[model samples]
Target: MQKQSKKGFTLVEIMIVVVIIGLLAAMAIPAFQKVRAASQKSAITNNLRQLASAADQYFLEYGIETITSAKLADADVGYLKAFKAVATESYPTDIESGTDIEATDVPTAVSADNTLTIDF
Candidate 1:
């Protein structure tokens, strides 16, 4: 009688494949988290830039030193739409030292150089 080759993978072969997949997943998860964090940081940066730009415009229009979050979000001026509906609260702080930028986290106001600075 002639011997026929087996068509299916052996137990060891299947285990090796599973281990490879597991290794790939383990490596991928952290990388994905990093990308997500980077994306969040970018969004926070954009938002801060928008806020600072609005503050600058408000200062130019009203000639005020300290511009709160309220006047910027005012519909008549429409300098910024960042803070609305949450009403009568303060502007969030901006910091760049976290895995994600929470709603409460935002950078300080425009600096003396007229640029937003991210606190680390």
Candidate 2:
């Protein structure tokens, strides 16, 4: 009679693999969250910058110091082609040249204070 050997992994081996996978996930999840938050913040900052630039352009073109967000975002004659909010943040309606533009109720994921201010 010929002796036969097991063809599959042992229970211990399977458990070891599961534990390794769990460890990897534990190390990865937080890093992924941090990266996601950073990306969101970056996108929000970019939106703020766009708003500032558009406000500047509007001020230069119309020779005015104050412009409303609605006017700057107007479809037909706005300085910006289109302004889209990246998150649930609210932008300032009244912007004055040489002053900072503030966005409120920013998503907590992007900012701790839930506010973003862009100085132009």
Work out how many backbone clashes candidate 2 has: 0
lDDT of 1: 0.56
lDDT of 2 by residue, 52-84 (tens): 999898888889999887887788875776656
State the lDDT of candidate 1 residue by residue for 1-120, as single tens digits.
Answer: 999987999999999999999999999998996676555446656665567777667667777666555666768879888543121123444322221322342222212232334431
Stretches of candidate 2 exceeding 4 Å from the true structure = 1-3
TM-score of each: 0.60, 0.81
Candidate 1 displacement at residue 16 in angstroms:
1.7
The whole-model lDDT of each prediction reads 0.56, 0.85
Q: Best lDDT goes to which candidate?
A: 2
